[model samples]
Target: MGTIELLMQGFAVALSPESIMFALIGAILGTLIGALPGLGPANGVAILIPLAFSLGLSPTSSLILLTSVYAGAMYGGRISSILLNIPGDEPAMMTCLDGYPMALKGKAAEALATSAIASFIGSFIATIGLVILAPILAKFALKFGPAEYFALFALAFATLGGITGKNQFKTLIAAALGLMIATVGIDISSGVQRFTYNSLHLFEGIDFLIAIVGLFAISELFFFLEQHAGDGLKKVALNKLKLTAKDILFVMPASLRGALLGFVSGVLPGAGASLGSFVSYTLEKKVSDKGTFGKGDPRGVAAPEAGNNGAASGALVPMLTLGVPGSGTTAVLLAMLISLNVNPGPMLFQQSPDLVWGVIAALFVGNLVLLLLNIPMVGVFVKLLSIPPKYLMPIVTLIASVGIFSITGSAIDLYFMVGFGIMGYVLRKVEIPLVPVILGMLLGPEMEKNLRHALVLSDGDWTVLWSSGLSIGLWAVAAAGLILPMVFGSILRGKMKRSKDGLVD
Candidate 1:
């Protein structure tokens, strides 16, 4: 069928009564989960996996629901970040740089409104890109072999390192940690346990869902406890919550630029929403006339919000088209796809055109709904943040634990969950970036498998690592990721020092 015909089929599926109900439920629940400090789309989806299965939802229906949740959570994150200075997720951190300041200035409603509109714009733009470019990218990715896949993974790792900037080292460290976690199960190639330590449960390996929930949701509970409790929410006037036409017109250019930049960065490995927000903020700083960027420029709020949402949408491109996720959240999405017996890759388009197109189409609808939901209901979301931390954290923990237990029905998984939660909390206290550990865990097996296969095919020839031109190119890029960032940091420091000495020329 032609693309248009295929999309029509997808619309029929997405607009079905059951799918619509599921989408609405997901959007509402996702917004609630994401509005809670530290609970993000990844965790939200992980926690809901068992629930989806309990409902016996079709794979397509489940995906639509989850995707809606993803979209809503992305929107919901801004609410807490802007109002309470507590970022709902890592990507929302950038939003807090100026967002909280605006809230403190009694512009909480305005900031939320602006962020909502920008999010809508960014998501819609990226969804359009997904619709148009998905098939083409899928066709190209179909050409990949094992070697090419390895090279692509390497490129993703390197790109993530570069895109993460100052925290790149921590990102790598996190990725390495993840790889180590992934090594715990039995070695399929050898049919012997590797990190099982002779435990019966270890033979199956650490469950990614358990690990993700512990790392994000459970760890966040500890942080929530440590902070001075009580709700940090502030009441804002409803009349003041609406955005002026001038406000929209003022931020239009910045939001558009940020959306475009975010989409491109999101498509690259490791870039994700955080890098997208960072780049968009930098560009806004360079271009905007307002000197109050750090204080509370509307543009500041608009840029990162737009960029991150765009990046979130953009991150899906590689996940669907290449079967390689660029971030932790996308990794979870990938695992979900695998569990659903849906293989995401080039052939996905041909094999499940309706599924793919339905998702893409739903994104368009979800963003529209989010914009409408957020603008009038900004007050409601802000009120959600008003729940006392003590009450909220316990409930969140209960949801997380119940969701996890339901998945495997294993007490052992619960133990792992708690243990990893402690580990995640400890790691966060040391100022490490959590993203890298996830990257390592998710990609480690693939990397090892490809490396082994390449060597075996080359008869244990060590030089085989550099045999393919693509392989060589990827390694070179990885080398650059290590070297160039340092050089750039030094150059930036020198320029700053020179400027301070009044030697600008």
Candidate 2:
């Protein structure tokens, strides 16, 4: 059957009463989980995997719920970012950079509304790309080998440079720390401990959830306490939530640009929403008017929101089409698929049309559902800003701690989380960016695995990494990503350098 016919059939399946109900529930739950500081889509989905099975859901139904949560979490993450200056996930990190500034200027409602609209646009673009490009991209991805995968990972790291903070050196240092942390577990190839320190818990290395809670969520509370002296950010005149026609028109192009760019980045493995949003934000900043980016612009909120949702949707392609997980969230999703006896690969479209198409259709429907659900609730989310610090901070901390403990079920994780939170707090004080550290921790091991795989395939010959045209092209792209940022931002370098030295504005 043609793609249209298959999609129509999928929509029929997804639009059923049961599917629609589950989609709504997933959307609500996803947003709630995503909005909660430190607990992101990955944690939300991971927590639900057991519940999905216990509920006796079919594979299609479970995936509908999970993906809805996935999409919803992307939408929900911006809430804490805009209101509280705390990012719920990696992609939301970019949102906080500008969104929080807008909130400080009493435009929290405007920022939230813009983020919702942009998210819709981004998800729409991703759905279109998935419907039209999945097969083609899957076909193209079949050409990838270990060398290409390694190069792709390199490109992911390269693209992340110099965007996190004023000091590239501090950023690299943070990333190296993550890399070292990622190496603490057993070596899969040699079956030898690397840095376990004879502790059984160290055998599994650090749990990603523990780190997220520590670095982003818990650390944030520490900073908030110190900065505010246990007070919330002062909010102002936050009861409005309507977007003007001109505002809509103003952001449409930026949203579209971000969605397209995010989709392209998402198609590649390992380059997920965080990278997509960061790149889109940087590119938009370069093109936008001066003094409007970091100072609080609606377009700033719109661009990253669109890019993040687009990248989140686009990352699913490789998971469903090639059975290769892109981001950590998708990896968790992939695990659930396997556990449910659903194999996702080249044959997924053919063998499981209902499952595949149903999920895709649900994504389309869920985007609309999230839009409707969220747009009306913008004020509700914005009101969260009004909660006083003494009450709200403890609630946030409680939520974060509970979420981490539930995920890990270890007191040790709590200890480590606190340690990392202290470290993160200190790093922020030193103006170090946490983005590089988080990305490095997540992506470094995968890159190392791919690099090792390529070396093994070529009998330990390093040249095998650059043996293919695809690999060469990817290397070129990686090189360009590293060089272009430095090249284009030379004007900002002196200012940033001075900022690091406390010598200039």
Candidate 3:
């Protein structure tokens, strides 16, 4: 089918009551989860994976549901950042720089309205990019060999810079741990037990959904308690959430710039929404002093919100085309596709055009739902900030427990979930990043498969792994991701110091 024909069919499905209901459910649930300091799209999708299974949703509907949550969470993240001075998720962290300050200045409603509009613009533009670019990228990826795929996975891990925390050693360690854990089950090549340990659960290894739920959702309780985050909450007074005509006019260009920037960044495997938002915020910070960006500028609100949402859409590009996820959430979505027995790659468009276009169509609806639902209802989401930590934390833990049990159907799975939660808590205490761990877990086995395939194709020739131009280019990118970030960071720090010195002089 042609792209337009497939999209039309997809829209017919998406506009149906069942698909629309699921989209709405995902959007509402995602907003609630994203507004929490503990959960975001990854956790929301992981926690709800079992729901998709239990409901026996079609591949198209299930994807629409999950992707809607993904899109909604990107916008919903701004709520807690603006109201509580707490980032609802990683991408929202940048929003807090200006959003909370705006709230402090009695402009909370205006800040939130700007955030919603910017998020819509970013998401809408990036969805258009997805529609236009995904098929082309997929066609390009069709020519990839095992060696190129292996190198691309390497590049994926290496390019995951800002989202994986600052300490490179720690990020590598977390990734290494994931790779090791992924090897726990019996080896397919040799038919030999690796880490099964005679346990039935070990026979299949830990499911990524179980691991993600424990690591992200349950682990948050520990942090909340340790930091005493619930007490002495900041109260934000909000009026009607609406942007003035002047405010709208001022932020349109900034939103456009952020959307373009974010879409480009998010196309890189593993870069994710946090990097998009950080880059957008930094660019706006340097643009001009007209609004004093750090001191509650509306343009500041527009930039990161647009970038993060744009990145959210852009992150799907690699996943849909190359079968490699750019962010943790997309990793979960990839896992979802796998569960539906649909492989995402260059052939996905040909093999599953209905599913592919259905998902794209759903994104359009989801973005619209986010804008319409969030803008006027910003006050409703803000009220959640006042929920007492004591009351809220336990309920979250309970929900996590229930969700895990629902999916696994095993008490042993609960045990593993609890164990991982403890591990997650310890890792977070030491400032280790969780995103790389997820990437490693998701991509590690794929990497092993590609490496083995490349060797087999070359008859055990190691140099064959770097034989092709594509593979060499991917390796070069991997090398650059490892080295260039540090150089750029140092340069940025020096510039900041010089600017401060000039101000003093």
Q: State which candidate has the highest lDDT.
A: 3
In TM-score terms, candidate 1 sits at 0.88
- Give the range where candidate 2 is weakest over 10 consecutive residues by summed lDDT: 496-505
Clashes of 3: 0
Collision count for each candidate, in order: 9, 0, 0
Score residue 142 of candidate 2 by CA lDDT: 68
Candidate 1 deviant stretches above 4 angstroms: 93-107, 162-166, 228-234, 241-247, 290-297, 485-505
Q: Estimate the lDDT of model 3.
A: 0.81
Q: Of the candidates shown, which would achieve the greatest TM-score relative to the real structure?
A: 3
TM-score of each: 0.88, 0.69, 0.92
- Over the stretch 300-412, how does candidate 3's per-residue lDDT look in tens digits? 88999999999999989999998888787887888778767788889999988878888889899988988889977777776776777778778777876776677667899
Q: Write the per-residue lDDT of candidate 1 for residues 174-231, one digit (tens) a residue.
A: 7778888889988989988887889999887887767877877788889888983766
* Candidate 1 residue pairs in clash (backbone atoms < 3 Å): 174-436, 174-437, 175-436, 175-437, 175-440, 178-440, 178-441, 179-440, 179-441
Q: How many residue pairs of model 2 clash at the backbone?
A: 0
Q: Provide the global lDDT of candidate 1 against the true structure.
A: 0.78
